[model samples]
Target: MKMVDTMCNMHLHNYKDILEIRRNTSDFMWCSRELNLTKSYRQYHDLTDPYKFQYDVFRSTDIQRLIEEVSKCNNCSNEEVSKHVVEILKEIGHTRQMAVFRCFGLCFIKVLKEVISCVFVNEAQILKLKSEMGGNPVIFVPSHRSYADFLLMSYITFHYNIEIPCIAAGMDFQSMRVIGKILRDCSAFFMRRSFVDDQLYRSVFKKYVQHLVTYGDAPIEFFIEGTRSRSAKALVPKFGLLNMLVEPFFNGDVPDIYFVPVSFSYECVLEESLFAYEMLGIPKPKESTSGLIKALKIMDEKYGNVHATFSEPISFRKYLTQTLSATLDFTKRDSVEESGHCFHLAYQIVDCQQKNMVLNTFNILAMVLTNHLMVNSLEPLLIDHVSKDVVWLSAVLKTQGAVVQPISHGTAVSVLMESIKVHQSLIRVSASGTISLVKLNNDKCKTLDPQTLRGHKLSTDMMNLAVPMLTLQLYVNPCLHFLINSAIITVIMQQVGANSHINKNSLFMKFVFVRELFAHEFVFYRPVETQEFEDALTKLELLSIIESEPLRLGNHQKLQALFCNLLYPFFSGYLSVCRFLLTADNLEWEERQFLKSAQERIEEELISGWLLQPYCLSLDMISSCIAALTSMIVLSKIRRGSQVHYKVDKDRLIPVISHLESLFYLPQKYQTRDQDSLEDTESIQVISSSEPLQRLVSKL
Candidate 1:
């Protein structure tokens, strides 16, 4: 087996548009009577039938062993639990029928061609991965961005002659009428969104996932994030599937397992508008056949390009010995060490996904526009000015380790114009050559019934900017992975005046506080406070904004301002949550009630001009703030039946609220000293790092 280093370096120029070759193939041979329909195809020779794999799972020794253990725990007869296990295997299993797969592929190909301009992939990476196949189970862990992720992997593997992976899909898709069975036949296995209450089902799922890893020939694909990131950012990974996938290797059932990290970048996301509505208080529409049919309207529009990059396959055995085994004992399955192993592995995959991401030109444009809006929301951006900013920002991001779409594709002006044409709905260039946001009608938001609202109902005034601003934020999100560290440092510097020389130890504590405060807003590898601080300092130095030895801000005011603007909206939202908690007359409130009222409070602040960013009126941010506060023990939850209520700990929260307030009140120009307020850091809640880290990890 071939092994690539743990940190795989992805070259932006290496990817080729796989669709280019597909479009050149003879239509007759590509569609009907293709290689997939032929008996001598690679899949036929190299892979076991998925139905046979399911049959083996149903009767596997692992399932039988689990049944015995579950029966003993539940005080049920072996026969009863055995019957339940069998029923579960039937429900959770997938069958890959070639005929149905080929039929769907044919139709999907046409849709892809009509809607998307190109599908870029690193053919060399796929070929390298193909060589690493067959000795052990291969787990394909992709970052989920859109529903298109499910189909993109299979499409690429089939085109490359690799066996299509049996995907772990949500049960929501299982009810999509004709699409459900077709998806199953194309190798999709359904699982409920959650099964923590159903012990029998949980046991079955664990054993079933292990069965696939231990015995199935094809690769197994699942999302590390567990769901589509409506914010277009990476989410904290869930460990349930990672645990199950690695159990076989620990049990000695398989020699080893391979974990592959896959990333998908869309120039223009198909569900961009829907995701924007979801960011506000609008409820997501259910996945139904009607919804799927209605979504076909996207075919008439352009979704510029979709880039898929596969990182090096990580060797489970080697990773265990070289990384986790140092501190964890693989012998104890339920021990804290075992939990740490799962989390480290999950974080590694998510990190790799971010490392290999391909940033589109629009991602850069979005960031520039967002910052521009911060200075002047209503003014139209001139094409020449935006082009210059895009070029400068692209260079800045590249230096900070981002793989931006090469400017060699065209001049910055032409590239910017082309990207605007692709996203004409969200942003537009008028005949007079001024670019501005396309706003959603206020009447559209006014018609939503209160019960149908996902969270708080926004006032018509707030609703005017809600959709466009949120959607623009979504585009800006993909760039956060590169900018997050520097942004954090910038906010810290802004808090303490530019001339202040602070102790590195004291600075790191504040860094920890800010990082944890937004833990739910961003995805990060935990238990690495020291490493993250050093990296942020390194990145800040790389950007020439700070000197690392004594940690002093540089004289580059423009660059510092960019970093500050990038994170202002999120900090504004969190500050609003903290302020709401500080002033609430009631000490305790239900969780659901808190989210609505907090958002309402923010809406009022927006109207009164106390809030700086309109996009800060977000339920998601408010909910994340509540989670962060709860994890920190600044707020404690009380469970009443199915609903959970929170009680504020004013003592712990006052410091947090004061700390956030002081940062904003500092000189915005990053110059002058707030000597008295600098002393207030003595009161900011001191976190003994590890306890809060473990608490948050345990909650996840």
Candidate 2:
């Protein structure tokens, strides 16, 4: 674990040959990510799907029989579900390699704090957090970046000698061959897609999650956004699992609920190269057997410790109050609270890591410089850069006593920064060290307020297309747009004594930037012919883009993120005018071009002319919607280069607000059947005969 200035009798730049010597001398050692396990994995019975976790012990066994015999049940037997899982796991052969259940069950049984310290860079931070929490179920909900989350969580819980809770995964991969067995073993159950007509499945999932939380058997894990975002920036939370995660808390069995928002960080992502290809208008590929192989080799034994830090928990009362407020404002509770918690926690822990962990000056320089290098607005950032940015940053953070270790010199800084610049999400790194941002979050990062001022300005194209930069990414804006504009368009049309049928069929189109002000000339999303779709998608697959069809409402499941990108601008433009500005007439031609693209390519979508669509809802109502959106960003002082962008003056903006007041402001249309018992059930008692569950309570 110690660093040395020289290699064993080696000259400079002999690292490659040294690697060869190590490979030849030590069988356990590996370099260039090669595990030399192709032979073992090729063993016909060694079926392993890296995309999903599949556990053998859970499959081909009577886990349900054991549970039922011990606990008893009134509903349909789990025998059938167990059978499905076993069958799938055996077929895919992926069940044997996963460590999820082993990690969870073992941690629950052993409760060793050493396991945690051994695998994390920020162990002390967590220890302090644990002492503060003093025992409650702390939910670790993070942005879903990869399947690695399973390992990261498992390792954290294992190291701390605590039991991490079961997670809820989609039926698609979680229930698929081999992967399903691993998930079930890890206490993960299948969650049905929202569009599925099966209410029974959803109910079962809700009840299962509730059982886990109410009994305090394990802490629960969930992804706020539901799925991994295509772009790297976090996406808004999808409510599919939120209601269930909180169900136990609402029932009152637990006195308090503490939500531990965790931020998962990695020096190098397993899926980076794969995701880069996806930004070039290619269809993304699914995690196939080969991809799984790569993932397993990389994961089964990566030397670097994964970092998972827990924030202070919140009581159930606070969560419930915040939840209600969020639902009312059409804002997410986790969004308001967790974002702050994670961001602050990440910076603090990362700062701690620099000083306490073995991070040298190289890492510090690389981390900051690479980040600065990615900034599109160089003038502003460079002014910060040439002034010895990281040095100043370390000094500023130190003024508040943040633990940022100093670097050796500017040389170490430049090398590390160059290395980081070589590795950026969605951004292409050229041989010459020139860089361009790529859209890594895919459609998930599509924001409503993105380039609001830029509109169709070609120079701001990167902001419009890729995951938003810290300076450019607007997390709260897209939800605001969707809530205020798309959903309300129909409601407003119905209220104003307009066409009722028109309202039902309309939905908004997602936007894409064809020509933008800031986009590099080398970066672009090209339209592919039908024959090229498969190939392009293959390349996208190689790029590791997370592309899930969020809403497959069409008779034909032909929706693409690109298509969404193409259509959203018009709808956003329309909504802006209605909600923020009086009109779009004052905006220049660049602002109008965004609408022009939507109009010209409108027919590309299957729902182009269909009634009840977000775009074509009226007067061709879609145009009016775009007009409203355009005005919001365009006419607002934000776009006018005023001292404060989007500054709302009550009297001046009230009229702008009044024009679109009805957006997302609707009466409760359907009452939830399970609203009465939002917390733990009264009938349940939380009892632990195990060490892990006992630890979870003590820590929470």
The numbered model that scores best in lDDT is 1
Query: Which one wins on TM-score?
Result: 1
TM-scores for all predictions: 0.90, 0.42
Mind giving the per-residue lDDT tens digits that candidate 1 earns over 1-700?
A: 1112354566767888988877888543664554532111122233446656656766777677887888899899999987887778778888878879888988899899888899999878888888767677788998899999979999888887777888999999998999999998888898999999987788788877887776677789999899999889898899888888887877877887889899999999899888877878788999999999998999889999999999888888778767655555556666634447777888888878887788888999998877665544334568876776677678778877888897742488888889999998888887887877775555777788987776788866467666777888888999999888778878787567668766789888888878888899888666665777787788777666776667777665667767877887788789888888888898999887887888888777666555545678767778788989999999998999999999999999999887777665311222212211211111111122122212211111
Off by over 4 Å in 1: 1-7, 31-52, 65-80, 326-336, 377-380, 408-410, 548-550, 665-700
Clash tally, candidates in order: 0, 83
lDDT (tens digit, per residue) of candidate 2 on 1-700: 0111110121112111111232235222211122222110012232243233334334213444443543344444567555654554333222223345554434332222221112333455455545544345566665465566765675455434454446666666653555566566555645555735643344334444554455433566777657764333344345555556564544554555566556554434445443322322223556454555555443332222233434334444554345323343213445545533333322222222222212222233332323332211222223223224345323423332223334433453354354344344323444644434344333422433333422221222222322222212111111221122222222332233211222222212111111111011111122212222333333222222212133112211111111222233333334333332333332233333434333323322212211111222111223333333334433343454323333223444454354434332211111112212212111211122121211211111
Name the 10 consecutive residues with the lowest summed lDDT in model 1.
675-684
Q: Which stretches of candidate 2 lie over 4 Å from their true place?
A: 1-100, 103-121, 128-136, 195-197, 276-281, 294-306, 318-387, 393-418, 421-700
